[model samples]
Target chain A: MVKKYTKFIFFLFLIILISSVSYAKPHKQLSDYNFFKDIKNQIPRDETVPYKIANPLFSDYSYKFRFVHMPLNTAAEYSYNNVFNFPIGTTIIKTFAYPIDERDLDKGFQLLETRLLIKNKNGWEPLSYIWNNEQTNAFLKYTGHTFNVSWISNNGQEKYVRYRAPNVNQCKTCHEINNKIQPIGPKGRNMNINFVYPSGEANQIDFWHDRKLLNNIPTPLKRNPAIWDDAKYGINERARSYLDANCAHCHQKGASASNSGFYLNIDENNSSILGIYKTPVAAGRGSGGLKYIIDPGNPADSILLYRMLSTDPGVMMPELSRNLQHEEAIPLIREWISQLK
Target chain B: MKINKKIIYFMVIIFISNFSYGKIIIEPGPNAYDRIQEALILAEPYENIHLSSGYYEIEDGLSLDIDNVTLSGDGLDKTILSFKNQKSGAEGLLVTSNGVTLSDFAVEDTIGDAIVVKKANGIRFLRVRVEWTDGPKSSNGAYGLYPVESKDVLIDSCIAIGASDAGIYVGQSERIKVINSEAKFNVAGIEIENSYFAEVTNNIAHHNTGGILIFDLPNLPQQGGHDILVKNNKVLNNDTPNFAPEGNIVGKTPNGTGIMVMANEKVILEENYISGNATAGILVVSYLDEYEDDNYNPLPNKIFIRNNQLNNNGFEVDKVRAEPIALLTKNKAPEIIWDGVTSFPEWIGLSKQQRLILGPNKTKDRKTDMINLNLMTYALLPWFHKTKEDYDDYIGEGISLTEVNFKTKW
Candidate 1:
């Protein structure tokens, strides 16, 4: 009888094991990928590499952590202007966290969500994970979620934000090119700047080249997009970089908002295509009673500035991932438009 | 303890069974938004998502990217998707997949466009109603059934109201058919912009800024919109003051205008019952703004307006845009008015194929009259201009446009 009982317990254990393993779909749980050595602190595993870009998309003042993990014997193909073609089995991971206090990073942060773009044979598949309330681990959430977060601004003012985590299709809204899902960040021009690695400060391109994560790096990188808030860069370059990061993902040729006829890529130098004296095509109520998209020497009359100042869903530019206006970006864009003539 | 174990086992079995059946029916409750969205995300091709009849309070925008899926609800009034508290995303529901049909539901008070189908072919909207509940306001969403950069679209038995822009807007699309629809109390009841091969038939448009507009703007991804037929539509009483927010091209549409065609090609306005409009029944004009696109043609070409029943129109012209044309016609707007701006020089009026032809218009009380303002002469030299009241020279049997047929069955 004892032997029979032992066999029955073994069978139940086997069934449970199989059931649990089958239920844990690949990327269903954050712990399944083994991307981080420490979840709370966001310490990357040995195979993962951290990277940064020159101009980051504004995400309601959330501090972002970016990392990439490639399989063995595979590397990303470098492109001159666009995002690199990542090989299959490559995973790009981004974590969003709001620092408790903007003045100091030492004061703990509230981790919100982590998004993964996994490169497969079919194409890139996006999966979002919402962090638990106890900040232990994240779980797969196909339908999006919203979180109420509060933080202290740099000026010692308290602010609250209803941070939204986008669903899977919403990920494709900005990360789309030529009717296919693509990575918006990580272009050559946006990643050629110096990054402070754990070892030391080194040019990111050279660092990736040394690590063999990126292939075919041309000597002396030709261009680099400027950081939007950096005062040392030219005003034109800064303004163009801001637009390229924020709007060009959908506004350029063959993208979502291409029907609008306004292209804001960093390389688009044509004044007409850049919306100088250009009339709105389908702006609708987003026009804010303005005429030209960019009126020369008149920032107040420019629709671009007006849209940036709005929080209404119909009127706001970059219609996702941001609810509050980026206060720091307004003055710089205003000055650039004021001196355009 | 034994009963607890048995209950856990039962629940697991139920979960497994549910997954195997592949059936999803969503009802209203807390987290209904996520449940509905999850169903859409996880639905396979050719799956039908049945929404139970209930009022669903949606918080954010919903989207579907799965092809060949049908999202159906109980009925238009039975299943209400209200987005009055939408906080993020520009539109209420966005469909980016091909061969998708959305029917038997209503979306109300969205922050932006109500339903936007983009980059999708073989899309149909049937028995769907999109509206702002409080009535016409400039702060309402721009488009009701908005489809752009798409092809093979059919919108039938739909109703749109209180939109700030066109109630039913199809832009940069091809092969569209909008029939048996009603649009009221919106700016530009139905607008076909930068599109081709559209048939707007058997629709009722009233109490809007302008009834129907076919326009081709410059610098868009698609230009030179052509080969559209606006027939058998009831375009009447569009006398609501233009509540469109400023700086939109539609805001320039004169209030109480029946049909306006601008800078398109081969458009036919035929058999439409147009009456009770305060402006001209049919107004055809060239693009008035300076454009930078070299490939764009700013002149309306080959516009044929015939067999349309026009009555009680142009009694009170829109003071903003159409009053000046009325002043040119003895302070009275006619049944049809053409701006008479051509790409050719004034001496060489127009080739036979590139003319605005109108004739045989059925009138109720007054005589059928039309005029060409010859506004280009006034634009070039204000001192030299003459209005031509005779349109017999521009009358003929115009070329026929092919009817639009869709490949997908809805």
Candidate 2:
């Protein structure tokens, strides 16, 4: 009896040791997760769905390829107003790439980095992987990386950007809310649009619900945020959508920059909280000698427009993941601010 | 010992803790940015990360989010972290976790704030130096040693300089202690804004716009800052031009002012060497802005000023916010000036304990006086304004605020 009890204890200890070792080490290579059917071509594997968001956050104008992979037996809980809460073992992947030449469609692009947010028992854990020079595989990177790339713009202009991949803690700058790291994209309104999937064209939330990857989504989900460049939507809606994607992640209530008292979320309705004639509290040099955050009819005097056009470290909005100003979006924002009453 | 569930749990905790806690030493090199950040991300509770003495050229902002971590360096002058080419992130170094001790290092010339610790508890910054290297420019980052929305903050023996905003700024925090520090060439040196229960003593603030200011602003999560003690500090020669960028609240601070308290309550200012400030030695005023928050009170109430050596102040009145008061006082602004702005109709029902009190102020045998520029009357009816220079009306005992102590937990 004593020998049997000792054997059982030894076996338990061995199992515990193995589990601890496995928990300490996560997947080191991007390919280890195997969510791609064709890694180079960016094809999704089983239960891995490609998705798109309206008014996507800008990263020096890098084109983002996004996908979500869920565990076999689980699904994400639907949220009406906020981001969809995913289950444990869900992995949201995003690959940032810069085209060799934006004027030429057939030309190839350079994949810079792949960021992953994996939800486990503890909470959402963010990881970043940097692609190699050969563009074959990506390895895990904890600290950030910066590299220079030049690409011809769609309008036949030469553009150069020093791209930045956020470090682990920098990821929390936007993703962490109320002391918990969570997904920032895939809000209900942002994902309520139609997508051209491999199977067919359908609304993204409906597609997820049909595939059994989303649970308890209410019927007649009819909210749609604007695709910032789409001219069919009103300019105010488009500009608010853009600000919601780029700046609201940190500027909203209970987020990272709540101390500033400037809330730019889509739901924020108060004009003062939206930074109209709002005085800066701690914006030292970022103020740019401007008076109000949004000086109506004067984009040049608006601090919001000034920060959007600025590429300086402290003066820029969104504050991370981009070093260059988004020229395509700045004019739209400037136009919107000029029209503000 | 018999095998029990408690024993098993204890053994498991010990094993897991043994695998995580330790010391990590990193030397500066081309890869120090990544390696240092990686160590900060992976550090466990109670871990000590020692950065060896060398100059590190960091390209991006570094952050640490783990609790109970100690990030130390060789010395403030030895281990230098320079962010001259920082292309991304808001601040140079951001600390978001609780119980973090950052000591013995120097951070220089980032595009934004040098060091910002936010939403933390029990944070300590010791023997650290943050400088812009370019003296007092409008383009320099805001706060040097900035701690906001924190609790039990202790900043000791630090040196901050050349920031466009305040050098040592503690905002929206509680139970604070800022001791033995030196701040120079910043807009507002050593500021405590919208915070509570702070003891600021034994510091030297010089060559800045306003030395040692206590302010409370509206539209913030924390409001009604009160119960602060500013004692035993040297505030002198803060005649640097106000180099803060426009639209910042601190940009309104007049050059050459010493120890201004605005829109706060239950403040005690005592036992400080204040001199050589061209503006007033101490300015107590109300919040002068349009605010929409209904829960906000924008008045300085229950202030006690006593036992301070004041000299050579109010000689050259600043052209900014202090000009109107200087014009009213005929260019000889008193050592202490109070914008006597009070709530209407409510002031008629207040006791002596609820009013501004003035004890005996020890001066340098100079003609040091106190003035109340009836600003409330001026705002209501400018034609009927009266400036009163009397210390007898405010002579009374004020409430005894508890001193801020952090010896028990921090």
Candidate 3:
């Protein structure tokens, strides 16, 4: 009997050892902030819901993958600003990476970092997690990082950049509306496009409504701003929408560019304010020697087009975020301006 | 417990010794921004915050609330703080402390003003370079070295380029000096607006829409700026198209303008080389000509133009000039122009000394100083300048006014 008891105790000890190893949290956790274990390995299999964007923002030519999660019965309120007011317990995840090759997805990609914006009891909190080089678990970091990323461009040229990882407060730069941290994209207009769900490819708005992830669901959104790169939309609409998404955030009232008299928001209807024969206020060399902001029917003479085509730090529009000209969109803008008699 | 106390005491002593032995040095890496921010927070009076030479890609702009601190970098060419991908922070660096000095660094590609020193005292920007890098984009930062609503400010030996607004702008600041600087590819190269007791000297302002603007705007916290001296500056070319957004005061400035003074008093312009501007050189106008300001003084008073080599201006004149200004100066656009509208309806007994006094000084090798002096009954209407009058009657003799200088330490 004593020998039998000894064997049972040994079995119990073995179970304890296995349990401790499985639940081991090697990296430290921040107070009241939830972080994923790893970008590739430890994303919750069934708990977290993964989503994708249509017409993603160019991050110096980097690929992005997104995911979302919320507590049971929680939903988001849709607003016209294109930002949804997410309920407490909602979590949004965005991962920036580069696919090793543009042609293949199965070979896997290099995952750099993942950012989590969580809505707790107080307000939305932004956090950053940097992945380890060995593909291990990521750790929460207050300081941002930079890594050299190489990618094969559409023209088959090898491109490289030192990709920057944003710090916690940096997220608020784009996320702010009225000195408050808020989401920029993922609004009804931006998300009206199709997404591949568990069932099949369907409109993201319909999918969200069906899943009860959104609140105050309109049968159809009042207005849907089209994706700037989509050919389905008219050229004028596309250009207007593109300027709205990229420039209007800061160019609007009370934002940084408010001091400037020009407004580039999509909703702006004034033709002169829309830069038709409207002389530049302070273009400097941004004019590229052009006389006006936009010379109707003359795309080459338009300062807007000149600034868009330039990569000079002293003379480019939308002053930041791009070193290379959008090779495809330039022609569309040129055509739009050329046809505008 | 006694042993633990002794150990803690030793560590504290070492930590204190570390701070005294060496100043806070910040290098570009993960959390480098945070470390710099924390160092600013923890720094004592008269401490140095030195950033090493490298490219620092920060996500947000930085701010300092510390007093009496010196913030320096390895060098302007070597240390580049880029906010090219910044998401938030209105400016690259915002300082609201008293007696802050920044030097030998380049702030590149910010979304807003590159460096804004607001409501501070004795602020200095020495040997700093502020640039957009991509050049001349309307969406570039507004001001490069902006010191607004501050007192006793000095911006010396700085290089500013690629701003949508003024490159080296000092607004609403008292007792300020901007000297030995280079400003190019901006709207207004160096603008001193609504500030009292200011001096701008030995600076190069070129390739901008308007080189060197001294303005007194309305509806600002500070107004009625007087006693300004602009001397020994090279104001050249500046024929770039006006890229400022509509509705801004600078937006109305014609391309290729040199030394424009609007709605101020006791301004002395002397010993400056003003040339190659497409518009008239040394344009002095009243605020009453532009936007309406009830509380602000619309008339420019005690403006003394002395010893300036004004030539080659009005080569490519702006047709959009207010009808009065355009009609008054039609042929070859005079070397100097003065809009004769004061605040009052009538200038019944105003002499050349009471109004604008031109040239007790030199105009290069030219004998006659061409002047377009107007005596408009009403300042608001553009047609008043078009009215048939003998503007040449007021131009026979050019007088002089009292010269002002920086009496206070600035």
Candidate 4:
């Protein structure tokens, strides 16, 4: 019996080691899959499953479910419900799946995809899904909060409403505020609380696993890898990259407001040290009328937001190379502003 | 024969008396270059080339060589001098020859220097705005209102913003005055380099990387600048970050000073309210590399540093290697007494530190009045005494410690 137990334990240990090594490996090109051609051929022919919804007998409770067939070889469905009793707005339920082969359940190419069941007044609803061969741009645009789509019920009733992505901008902007731009997505905005997806699990992989969505999870990538990996960059790498591309290119000493002693160097520790966001009550021509310009949490009241939103060539941000409006980034910024606490 | 000749001369004189005076008005349409050029050459002096306040693309530089000629515009904001297609080797406006005034107009998006005036006297730039369309980091264009080697220039009430170099530069020229004008959002605002007899006053110098630098660099033959006074100006908050990669000399020194006096003589920095800078409030230094011999000389000689209130500020006056040593040494010693004489405790000799601690000794005498004196007998007391006894014994009696009774000739 002892020998048998030792062999069993050793076998389990070996399996765990092999699985960890495979998970550690970066994602490979999709062409490596022998099933790629079949999936590509099948994607165009698969009919777009119309969106569906179900309303139970609960009073004043409504739920929405949606599915989109994309040009790329991918499919997604999301569901959400308005719960009047809960003050936190809608509860979102989202799930994603891709075709796997049918064999021994553990060994099969077919896998039970990660599913997100966000609690609502009536029941659970899915919000978002991921597929194996998705077009990155189309996925970002369609899943973006700016789009309005139609959802049909099983009884043939259609409802149109706007759908939004999770507030990723809020997570990206603050970590990008200083020189080090670490997007603390899983970590809360305050860098204190870990973001556990509705499930009580603290670890992102564990949380996804508990939801019965993902069997193998990929490691998360940092928001800005190129600049953060460079050895010469110091301190707030992400914030520095954003500022250098945005504000500092025009707002530095000698370049523009040289007389005001307002050096916006990202490496500098104190924001007020260089008079960047300090109130310029009588700063002559360089002063932009608003008082206490960088008021931390208030982007609308802050002069920095006012300048970013301006279209005038003299007052607009970057002062060059921007041809299109960044409509999606606005809400993310608003969310970032709300999360300053 | 005489009558026939007279009749022919009378007919010839009568036919020669017919003429007409006409005026030509040239209006340049949008994107008109060839028509504007032809009109400029053909139109006589005092004739107007009325532009309709649209973007005018020109290749060659605009030169106003005629005297009393006016290049009027609809307004400064409406009319634009855009050089999008022009090559990089051209200036926006080249004004030479006297009596040229450009007013109420803007010259922007130029590839080269914005405005260059060479050897032009009596040049007036009133309410003239000059800028380039390149983002603030671009260095393709330099100088907003540039007057190089020109004399009797006046740049009044004009705004020069976002230039690669100084906003209003008066280089190698004399008798220039910049008043009631603003040059912010540029490399340097109103740089008076290698120029004499200029006044920079009552202007707000803020939000720049460097605040109000009067630099005298090495290797320029035109080195001497004197009689320049920087007074009554609010020079603050010049600690902004630098965007461009182009090297700046002022960055080598402290971040911002109200006035930086370097290698120039007879500069008066008085009564200016300067504060809130990352570095010193005022920096005065001589060029160390350029004039090696003069490095040891006392600068700001005949300078009056009196009655100026400096609050929350750092002040640095850099005297070269040789001059400030004696002044620094004399400041260390507290008290000096010559010709030792002692008798009383009140008349006791005191060391410099003792005198500093207790302050000056005093006494009172009663005779229906008060008389104060330090007698030689008081020297015996240890509390009030600071002098060595050997020096006291050497001098012996009847000599007052308070009085210097002898002198030494060196």
Candidate 5:
């Protein structure tokens, strides 16, 4: 009886070892974290771990679901106002999807494609994995593909947009800084907000700390970075934060639009660089008859507002991934500018 | 052993023609996009990337960062590269390499610029047609056939249209020639800004906000534009409404203006047909009239205009479009208006012969502000077109500048 029990335990151990080895690299088509299935487990397999953010860059009303998987025993360095220094081999995944009815949050969504930013030896490499129509699996999309996505808005209106999945080079358009590829979000301030993680609701920083995935972060953190849409923050703070995340990626110093002499970052103390009574450099019809980028105390005459409200391909701000204007944010920005005095 | 010297020489010629210089033809299909990108990437120096006649819809910007590579299509109209659905990046095709020639193709409807050649030298655009499919709209891309911050460039036999900014623009570069091109229906039809030693000749600029603009703008990485030649070009009827984005410099250009020069040294305009514009045929202004640009020269020095036919100007000036311009000037503006603004403290230091040189031109019956500085309200506003009290004071012809020889520079 003793020999029989020992033999049975040895066989089970052998089976577990073999399965774990196979799970390391499932296939080239599928991600290492499996499909969007299991996410919160100690060794998440088949199940997906769900995550959310306080604010996200608008993408034509398309909702996003993000997940992260870290190799065990690895930790990310702590940085302020910048992305967490993640270890090599960490994979950050975001799936672009849309709800059946945008007015109803409870409505189920149709998954489109998943973008992965895998941290490699050089840096994070961005790739797109398109989900099949049947919602079973996703395959690596080397070349970009486009498809029609239809949805219902809160007003009970039918809407549709031709969604374009960005190709690999397009991914580098925003991710690149000073010729180096980096992540746009996941900054310390963006992640400091409370999140409904698997172990109930808590600050994401604490959650990451408890999971031993982050370096030494002080208790209560260094600074509270305001999420742009939160009403608790001041309007100036919120508006500047929104512009920093969306526009500064290309408009700041040493960026693609550096020649334009515009800076929308949080650290830019100069009000003029934030587009106060500033003349445009090469904005042809994008000006919309507005004399300055911002006419202090007059939001109606500001070129900033003109570009925000416009949908014309050349006249729009934050050039891509959004066809519709962020109507809700525009008013808040207008109010912020009106009170600039 | 002097056996068959003629046969050996013929074999040598065949070998040289076959392998050392060869062409690779790429076909169109499902795999063509990736195949072409790979060919562009894997192409070696002195290699030719030839594409068969077909229409291609590319989603991402195509970039070439290698040297001595030539990309050619079957013909300009036969091969079309469209970037209407670009996901990211700015241009349809971006180049950061030297010794690259893009020829015999049409790039249309890009999200941003059609082709942007930057920070490289010895680039040439031959028999290329860059256009926006939609007619002149404010939402069109900024530039077509753009080359910035490169040297020894040639843009020959090209057609550009429907750009929000300049149809054909060369900026912050040196030793360039833009000849035998047609630019129309854009903001500034053909603009050479902040560059030195450029010859723009034998081009047609029509129906734009301002045809043929040479400006030295402030707050850019490059400044102090000088030594440009504008000759043998038809700058006609550029009365299109300004559709440029509000912040760009050209966006402020009034409709129906032709051949604008601002803050440059040593420019010669000669032998060109300048007609049918409403505002003015030749407009020279100081940079101080526009923005608060510090440490930059704002004077127009050693300019020579000769042997040009100017007619029918100020006929259909769009006064309501740019009301500030109309508020300062009359309905019949002028054939040549020089905003006589000079901040030189030593007023008596320079002779009259050292100023702008204008000669050998004729215009219709008109009494206008040739040196109009009536709008110079210093310390009042940052008006781009400043007013000068002595706007029509100076009359003596200055010394003619030496003609820039392109054959020697190139």
Candidate 6:
């Protein structure tokens, strides 16, 4: 009986030693583990209830996104495989997993849970990704279990970095292609999860419809008294600010365009002097001999569209150091160019 | 803290030294001359006296014996050193010491020479202009720039006009160079006499009685003027309709030569655009009698005249006679015999046989008729009769009336 008890204690000691060693190793290589295998199986096949995101510290945040419906024949008639041609309301919800340092993982999860609120018809709906039997939020299956959230202060004095699902490097590698200037949330090609209701209306769609925040959202019919004020987030201001931050760093005077003599300063109100909205006669960058980058009322012919769609390092947008292609920002830019009549 | 205090003390010493060696400024007033004299007495070597931009009219010439000093002004146009009423026999500014530089000022109507540098070496005149009110023929004033017995001299970006003698006269000087300067409306734009190893390049000698002259005349003790180079100069509009008094003949100095090198050995005249003159573009004659025996003889050697473009835009001969002549009769005694006969050299006229050997007729046939006999006799006769006694004996035979019907073209 004494020998049997001693053997049992030795077994317990062996198990404890193995568990502690596993936990002590750095988590940099943990991404190789299939953490999403079980969660992906729970995602619904129906397009309306496509997926939900969950993490170890949060509950489920229900969301679904899809391409706009089009006639089969009409889709087949278009030869070019461009995703930008889809109807204006088309969207997508992507999901991924990121392994972070254990010390930061707790804070990352807390920040994500606190900021995960959905703006519904009535008001903002406070929500969290549902946690499963493994103590992880179920919504992580659809919107990635890990995410990085960062913001530069309005005055540009400081930058704050927090991780809800992923650390700064893990999220920024794909999201911050042209640095943190690009939107990483899901409303666009960013990390923000887009939640849709059963009636197929986008959450926060009021900013585009009731608030008139978007200038280029086409309406089926004209209604009396516009839904929202026109001053907020007008398409011109949005597109101009976006291009200035993303493209003008190297294109303005004394930068890379020092040889080309083409300056694109965002503050310049004179379109004639800025050389925008006009064909670049001798742009060294090959965008298929395109005369202009922003053709009025015709985004298909613009070279800017070609550049944004290209994954080729020789022809990519921003021309340097961009990782993931900004899928949503490209379409918005295309729509802005299309509406430039 | 100890190291910091030591560094502070070191920096203080450096600052104090710099303050003690700062530039000194000189302002002109009633006591301006007195101040300048005191500065000259106390100036250390490598010091500069910067004169403010103003007019300085002196009753007497200012002389300096300071070495390695510069008397500079704010600018040439603003700094006026007027000696209009000064009766001083010395120059307006005289420097006897070496390494003296004067710049950015003007000297006008000095009673004597405008500037005189004696026994000075490495003297530079930068943008300093000297002029006289009387025309180029005026005998009251002489030697606008007289640098005698000096060495290693440079006269750059300066202008001199209306001198009784040569506008820029460098006598008995060595290793001198004059560049990017102008001598216009003067008796002689530039005259380098008894100078060795000199270069006169990139200058404009225009509208003067005589353009550029390199003469080796006898009478001076210091000889040996050789290896002089005159290149890339524009000598134009020198056919001024005024002569330099009775004995002093002028008006482009005959043959309409833009550059005249009389008795200069090893002289290189290259890449010069000499145009708009009445005579040949370049005249190289050996005036052996003009100089005393001991004076420099710059002749009897190689002279390279190459790449010169000549245009005969000179005035008519009848117009040449209208110029006045100012003869220097002070040292020139009256001739004991005033003979009506004058010897005209055969080389003066364009004979058909002579024209064939002289290559081609550069001047048109009408130019021969325009030759002023009186001016020619005055310029050549005195020296000609003095040198050649047969010129007095058989002078009448040389003056025969001959006409040739050959049409010449310039």
Clashing pairs in 1: none
**Number of the candidate with higher DockQ, 1 or 5:** 1
> For candidate 1, what is the DockQ?
0.44
lDDT of 2 by residue, A69-144 (tens): 9999788888866888888889999999888889895697888899999988899999999999989888999887
Tens digit of per-residue lDDT, candidate 3, span B301-351? 878777788878876667785445555566667677776665443555454
Off-target runs (Cα >4 Å) in candidate 6 are A1-341, B1-22, B133-140, B241-257, B288-300, B313-410
Q: Which DockQ values do the candidates obtain, in the order shown?
A: 0.44, 0.53, 0.04, 0.01, 0.18, 0.00
Residue A154 Cα positional deviation in candidate 5, in Å, after optimal superposition: 6.3
Model 2, range B1-410, lDDT digits (tens) per residue? 24666656655565576567699999999877888999999998889999999999987889999999999999999999999887777899999999999999999998899999999988999999999997999989999999998899999999999999999999999999999999999999999999999999999999999999999998887989999999999999999999999989999999899999999999999999999998889999999888777878899998899988898788889866786676778756788889888887754445333547888886687546999988877778889888888888888876788878764253
Tens digit per residue, CA lDDT, model 6, A3-55: 43454545554565566566422122112222232333323223212322110
* lDDT tens digits by residue: candidate 4, B1-410: 12344444444444332112123433546435445544443444445555656567754345544443445566678677766565312356666545556666787766555777655556677677776555454343556787755566677777766665566777665666666676666556567766666676666666554456665543232446655666566666655443322322432334333455655555555556665544445545544332222223222221222222333332221222212212222222111111122222424344211110011111123111111111222234536633331212212111111211112110
Per-candidate RMSD vs. true structure? 6.2, 3.5, 11.6, 28.6, 11.1, 35.6
**Model 2 CAPRI rating:** medium
- DockQ for candidate 3: 0.04
Q: What share of the true interface contacts does candidate 3 keep?
A: 0.04
Give residue A301's error in model 6 in angstroms: 99
Cα lDDT, model 2, residue B297:
87
CA lDDT, every model vs. true structure? 0.88, 0.88, 0.72, 0.41, 0.75, 0.49
Name the better of 4 and 6 by TM-score.
Answer: 6
Clashes of each: 0, 0, 23, 58, 31, 46
Model 6 TM-score, all chains together: 0.41
Model 5 agreement with the true structure over B1-410: per-residue lDDT tens digits: 23254544454455455448457788766655566765765577788999888988776567776588899998889888877776544678877678899999999998888898876678889999999988898778899988987787799999999999999998887888899999998998999988888899999999999999989876566778888889899999997888886557787687888898888888888888999988778887766434544657877776777778888876665676545446666656667766665554433346443346666676556432354543344333456555542423443464443443433221
Better of 3 and 5 by lDDT: 5
Q: What is the TM-score of chain B in candidate 6?
A: 0.70
| All candidates: TM-score of chain A | 0.91, 0.92, 0.78, 0.28, 0.85, 0.34
Candidate 3 per-residue lDDT, tens place, A1-341, comes to: 43434545455545655765775232333212343434464354344566655445555666767777778787778765557788787778777777777766566778888777877766777777787787654567655666778877656778776566765545544565554566666766677767666568987777777788878877766657677888899988888777777667656544444433356777887665567766554344455556566788999988878877876544566554455676777887898899887
